[model samples]
Target chain A: MNMLEVTNLSISFGGLKAVNEFNLTIKKGQLYGLIGPNGAGKTTVFNLLTGVYKADTGTIVLDGQDLVKLSTIEINKAGIARTFQNIRLFKELTVIDNVKVGLHNGTPYSTFDGIFRLPKYFKAEKEITEKAMELLKVMGLEAEANFTAANLPYGKQRKLEIARALATSPKLLLLDEPAAGMNPNETAELMNTIRFVRDNFDMTILLIEHDMKLVSGICEEVTVLNFGTELTHGITADVLNDERVIKAYLGD
Target chain B: MKKLSKSTKNSLINYGMVIALYVVIMIIQLCGGLSNSMKGFLVPVCIYVIMAVSLNLVVGILGELSLGHAGFMCIGAYSGAIFSKLTEDTITVAPIRFTIAIIIGAVFAALFGALIGIPVLRLKGDYLAIVTLAFGEIIKNLVNVINFGVDSNGLHFSLKSAMDMGLAEDGKIIIKGAQGISGTPQDSNFTVGIILVLITLFVVQNLVNSRDGRAIMAIRDNRIAAESVGINITKYKLMVFTISAALAGAAGVLYSHNFSTLTSAGDKFNYNASIMILVYVVLGGIGNIRGSVIAAVILYILPEKLRFLSDYRMLVYAVVLIVVMLFNWSPKAKEFKEMVSYKIKGMFAKKEETQA
Candidate 1:
């Protein structure tokens, strides 16, 4: 029932190992968390998972498809979608259009269909608009669908990124610091949104976060990483309470 | 896009603007308000409009700088001119022949655009601009050294000269070295020019408002985010780049036919020519397709009309550029314009409500 199985994932920059021997497994529709301190290669692990950085040695299998050596775009097409640690919304595009860009692969019409404005173009576009709107409404952003993404409030921008990621309709969603700068209330809202997406969209999420409260609140399981290697991982409560994980996070 | 959609509204506005310009020109012609010189300027104006609009695709939407746009234009002009020159005897029908020539120009320019885009688009930077700048210079110089001819033995070409072509005694040089192509059937007219402008507008605007266009702009806005969302960066970038080049080719075909002789010398396919088109795109509000059309008309016509400004024509042109830049880009000016437009819309809404 595993949707994503990654083992022995490794990458290096020069002589330094950025992420080494990373192993992760997420069951279908499970919520997972990856927590690590600064310079501990959490984002690098996300990059490795998304094929942004080709793993030096590892096997990433999503729904029985081998993901290694695939390009970032191909990895996405293989059902792995990610959000950046820093919000990377298409800032100038409208909120709905950003989601539609994610829905680009699902667009049934060709460029020719679009250029000629054929009947199929109209039909396909209507479908795409409705679908993108559906995703925005799920993210509670229907009202600001026409607003440019950069103009959105910070909490809303984070939600927009999640909406865009869901537009890809991937089984496994990778969120890197989704609640990075949110206030406490926004973080609580995001936790609920994350759970809502996982339940309603049939999505399995693996997030990296520094916010311990958010991680423990929604994560079914947690993995602690330090200095390019796993510190420990288990049930969310146990991992958060582990002495070594705490020492790794805040040195004694 | 569906009817009354945001993009649909923008596209209708763009199409209406171009159609309105066409109507205005026709009216001036009917009233004999157009002087001979002004009449001569019509096709050139359309040509620049097409060029600016197409360039905006690359510079504005796709967010790539292309300095070699004129190189593609040169390729289009020469390829189109060569086809027309050789087919002068067989394709006696000017319309069919010119249509084929435009297609040839577009294809060749697209071929080169893809050729250059493959290497440059892979790397993220102003590499495209730098390489294209060099490409424009090289293509211009390259045309000068090319010699082309036709004879009983078929087509012959050489880099040296007409003598090096070694054609049959009955041969005629279609493209003599340094002289470029001559005797190309001048099938271009203002009506045709405007029609082609409309077609180019239709293609570029439609592309900008489509799924592919959204992907392209996403890549422009954030390459990493676009990649994560499954948009193929190279494919979309190259697609827009090729389309832009092809439209420039069509414009080049129109331009070459405007002249009795087609040559690479002067501002026709030089670096300055490419920069001039870029200026229109930038001053026109980058991704604003309709703005590009207006900028091309005003910037192109102003200097000619202001030739009456005597020695200060260029000075006046510089001032006009500053004003246009301010009007198009200054945030305060943008806010003011938006406020005015809102008021105008409100007035219309109130009138309709009262009538209701």
Candidate 2:
């Protein structure tokens, strides 16, 4: 069964269609890539899918649940988690605490349990901490778990964002420009981490990337967007070699 | 045995200050070192501490600037004071009546908090602050026009006049317009105030340290990221705001019961009062619970202590505030503060080991 099916997804701002009639489908455990020019509404598509932007028309079905009209948080609970292009970490919090915030939805303790420090609170908190620590370790961020998130080096901060997203345990993860700031060495490492996450978590992953090298490295299937519409989509090599995608990237 | 975690150590230090302050106050009372005026200020200081700590939950943790905390206090004060008054002749026991009154006040304030928060919390930053400020003004004006009375039949309330309340000849007036509630039972004392502060600390501290608190802070740090992480933003925001308002209401109960007469005007429970409470949170260092307590106490007491400066009293107080703000927030000072706190933590660890 398809893990996600977005059909005729459309949104506009002041008569300009920011994302028009966008459609996508990904099978379970597929590594998908979304590549577009700067103004092609790639981020807007992510926004619509995650409920940040209300669609004018269309449906986002993830694992058979309709995501339209749901709030961002509801969509998240419905198993869609995403990272940002700008790297939004809880900067003042410790790295582990940032991950723990992602683990919050899965914890079963009520507010009363938290305020009273009930046995349930401890049990859930311990499990969350252990899980958060494990994610940090997987990202090679165990040594920096206690450090304030903003204090980390730039590359580690990117890795931390992915680790934090994974802590949400989403059925489908959306990563936005995960390698935007990294060097070649760091980008190679992130590519490995991305594949490792898909295989280990057994989750479908979709990513938006500006780097052709990074997208071609791991994306099994790729979609190209230009001017708020899909230009082409096929296997990675075919999509990259498409005449329309070349024109969209080169302008005019 | 495992060593203490950073959070555990931090909380120990926080509560330790509370206990130490309580001990010092008890010692001073026993030794009769405080003058009459200083003694009079003790309960008010405790009340301010509770208000500041509670306000910090919204201003610091939730990252929403609220300017109508005093409005919640007003709701709490009037409700609590009236409850205590109605039960005065019937209950005959002070502590039980006061306890019930505090709960009533907190519940009413919490209800209003949820009501107002639903609409106002949708706005953010300066807009949120302005709406809350308007709410505070509206509350103050509403209280000014209110006329309430209690009779053998039941309670009566009217906005027009006391005559419109339709009370019996022997009925007692509970609220009389701008004069506010009078003849309220003065059942609250310094000890009781301290106990309530401990309760406030327990609730606020536990909430801050818990997983829920992490979610709230995450929302504060980055709203989009928090939403994408499956956190119910409205739910958490309402929870913190209501809890904060409830605690402010409890503080209002303490404030109301400390005196036989309570008024809601100007310095009492007005806009300035709300801003003053926010000042306590900001000046204390946002998100620093222990700092809020200490700042509220010292700032509340400073004006009284600076009376020796006479005409220049407020000027000196202003200077002190500026100096403290810079010292607390300036980058260089922040580094110095971290170093000093690190040293203090080391000392505390050694002290703990010796005791163990």
Best of the candidates, lDDT: 2
What is the per-residue lDDT of model 1 for residues B1-356, given as tens digits with 9 covering 90 to 100? 43497677888887887788889989989998999999889999999999999999999999888887888889988999999988899999999999999999999999998888888788665776888899899999999889999999888989998899999889989999888888878889998999988999899889988999999999999998999999988899889889999999999999899988988988889999999999999998889898899889988988899988799999989998999889877899999999999999999999999999
Query: What is the clash count for each candidate, in the order shown?
Result: 0, 0
Residue B125 CA error for candidate 1 (Å)? 3.2
What's the lDDT for all of these models?
Answer: 0.90, 0.91
Which of the CAPRI classes, incorrect, acceptable, medium or high, describes model 1?
Answer: high
Native contacts kept, each candidate: 0.97, 0.84
- Superposed Cα deviation of residue A124, candidate 2 (Å): 0.6
Off by over 4 Å in 1: B1-3
Residue clash pairs of candidate 2: none
**What are the TM-scores, per candidate, against the unseen true structure?**
0.97, 0.96
Model 1 lDDT, full chain set = 0.90
Per-residue alpha-carbon lDDT of candidate 2 for residues B1-356, written as tens digits (9 for 90 to 100): 88877777877787788778888988988998878998899899989999999999999999999999999998899999989988889998889999999999999999999999898778899999999999988988898889999998888999989889989988999999888899998988988888889889889988988988999999999998998998888888999989999999999999999998988866768889998898899999998998899999999999899999999999999999999999989999999989999999999999999999
lDDT score for residue B74 of model 1: 90
